[model samples]
Target: MRFSREDLARVRLSAAPDPLWEVALSITKLYRPNVTEPYAEWAAWTRNVDDLRVRSAARVLGSLIPSRGYFPDFLTPADGSPSLEEGIDAVLRTPRRKLRANLGRLGRLPGWAQGLADGDPAALGSLGTAMRTYHDGMLKPHWERIRRRLEADRATTGAAMLTGGAEQVLSGLGPAVRWRDPVLEVDYPVDREVHLAGRGLLLVPSLFCHGTPVSLADDDLPPVLVYPIAPGRDWMRASAPERQLEALLGRTRSAVLRAITYGGTTSQIARRLRVSPASVSEHVGVLRGSGLLASRRQGRGVVHSLTGLGSSLVAGDDAPWPAVNSAQPEWCRPTPPPS
Candidate 1:
């Protein structure tokens, strides 16, 4: 893809994962045969889900999104709304001409889909219902894990951009993408070029986008690149180790540590734990001093993330704890009384 100076200047990462994009991409993953590690367990679980509503919803989405091929761009609108309801509303509100043009590209749609292509109201309503049902059933259960993983990715990308500019962010988007000055080359199924004529690009990190990065097939639409994230081994499973840590640290302190699985500011962490900012700050100071967490200034507030020792502790690994010292304090002792 070709990028101009304005395009480069306007480049920004999505603050959070796009729900519609994820729902569309995840549908593609669900239909794939012999899915591999990272996705294998999820695919298995989804296949075994016995809800008739979910199954019906999946069928509706599956009919639109092929396992490997072009899906309608209207399905994944680029309105940048974080709310799924708003996104779906945007989808349902797609102009008839645009819908026909996008769906027509697929060639030879089924009779039922013709109604959707012709912008029939009943068809649009059914589509919206299917999307909501599928998302609530499949994605909602794992939304927290998904949000944490994407937020962590955004944090890493943001740090790179802060340190070295947009070029650094582009260069580091994994091996599937290559940054060669003016043009960014991607490993797409079809050989295509997207020239962002000063509109810039939206970089979205997705949990369901596997292998090569995906973008809208239509160049005329808003330019977006949805890439995959490498989630931790415990990403899907509930962290039982947090409960164990509660034995070492008190309940509130343990809750604070668990809240920082991905990373957050004091205020963000406080909101997650539903505690006061002062309480979070005191707990964070202790965690930071004990060498279980690290904090760095970002703009007005500091972002805190787990240190190596803290990560192992949270994951319940058998790695030996760091020796006690003034520089590297121990966190194994009882939680200090909050000031």
Candidate 2:
């Protein structure tokens, strides 16, 4: 394939941005909140475990998210009293190895895997806390900020969807964002930063303890922080339907269907997707065009509803949609392979 300078520019500019935090966000939002589906499923799996399973599951889930890879850190013996060193060794050696490798930061990992390969499992309880700290203290705060900004942007975007001023649309909203000098160490190359700067997304490294009753604690694992570079550019896309189904179904559309399964509208879908109403309208257009949705003009504007096809689309059916937009830089959808 031939590449344009602009295309290459965007490629060089690419880095996993803030929403990548969605992996952790999914876990926490599911399990941490009142029970969610995944959490309920996970809990169901753990319910039968004796104490040993409990600790092992905790250790494994701890290592899985930041690393976003699954390894069976839990599944060892909880013999009367497990050794802290043994637990640490099990996780440090097995799950931790998998985690580092996946993040592509394994070289930076402590050989503590081999060292703790023989350490205490009890220490692993603290290990979850440590890993959580790296993820939560580092990535989480930034995530909330980005999510909040994205959500707010969506509201204003929705309000202006009927109107046509990208400038006035944005201007009415004001600058709408402010980010202080990063509170974390970023590990990306300077060129990547340059790229991100242009794209309006920022990725930083979150290392060490900050904002507390006292001083910094020396014993904490530093987490890699990934967040929006342009904070505002989080809304850079009019419609990022890079994937085929996404182009057709739309983020807002998918959100709407999900809500429909639960029940939702353009306003509600916008609220859920953290996108603007106009963005929602754009998605609704795609869905309606694809015959996956039906819309009617009500008092002031359009009200959209899922068609029978939309119902199937939401039920995990993807074959009906054309794979036309896959090559469009602005569209995307990654439907999982059927089992």
Candidate 3:
């Protein structure tokens, strides 16, 4: 049981957890250092657990081999003991030419990248037509983005948990991490356990966002979270409010939201809603002028969407919002019978 009766009682106290939950967890694990609690390892380890493996990161790498990088005649163990670092390096350090050559081998027009393509390809390939097309085409740029993200991922406590042998090869370049010292301080119903070295300090900025008190740590880079618990106290607390909020955002249907949600820029939103381009533009303009929506142009045709207040109303929330959705557009929407 990761949670207790008393801990569970305080779960709903947060109004709006400022930091992300992963940031919260990473902070807790690094500062508090929980050793006992029967299931700690499983709890932390599962974050990167290869379960969702629609295509493992390696698979993503393999896909771009022919076009982006050179595959060394290297064979490494897939199991836990071999060290995750070696595995990643194998993918990362493979000679670029080899990767490009290998890519040339497979479905040159491969519908399903040999499980090694990183990010989106059709989007990346437009940038070039090189020997290491996918790698140069897709993976390399994504890796740069990924590298920066990994740095942020390693910032809070990414150092200690060496995924493979990454730390061994790049000593000093390793992540900054430490065992939690006693006398931990924390925010309750916490999305993450805050772990600090020593303090009656009463103030340590949240690791992820220095400006805000830490909420939770889900680690954006390699996508791992840390949990800090002193030898005991294995209790579960609902994560920071933002996690739920993000999840809600993630689940939100953008197209449906456009049609049902209200705001501005009918042309921009209309393109998205798949309704008559003009009709979408007209309705969005109405919503905006009527105070049912708010919008800002993000370059691609002054985009539109519902206002905060508007979304709540459409979401069935009574936060005093104007009706954003008009009669659903006729093109894709179900037709109503004549009165």
Among these predictions, the greatest TM-score belongs to 1
Model 1 lDDT at residue 280: 95
Q: How does model 2 score by TM-score? A: 0.24
lDDT tens digits, residue span 75-174, model 1:
9887464657778999999999998998887777766778998899999999999999999888887675677678779889999999999999999998
| TM-score for candidate 1 | 0.75
RMSD of 3: 20.6
**Candidate 3, after superposition: displacement of residue 159 in Å?**
27
Judge candidate 2 at residue 51 and give its lDDT. Answer: 46
lDDT-wise, the better of 2 and 3 is: 2
lDDT of 3 by residue, 1-339 (tens): 122333223222111111222222222232223422422332233232233231132233233322111222221111111122333334344444544544444435344433323324542332122223322222232222222232233332223324332222122221323212222223333344433212111111112222122221221111111222122121222123323433543322323343434233555343323356666555555567756566686767575656775565444211222223322122211111111
Segments of candidate 3 deviating more than 4 angstroms: 1-99, 102-279, 289-291, 295-305, 316-339
lDDT of each: 0.80, 0.35, 0.30
- TM-score of each prediction: 0.75, 0.24, 0.21
lDDT computed for candidate 1:
0.80
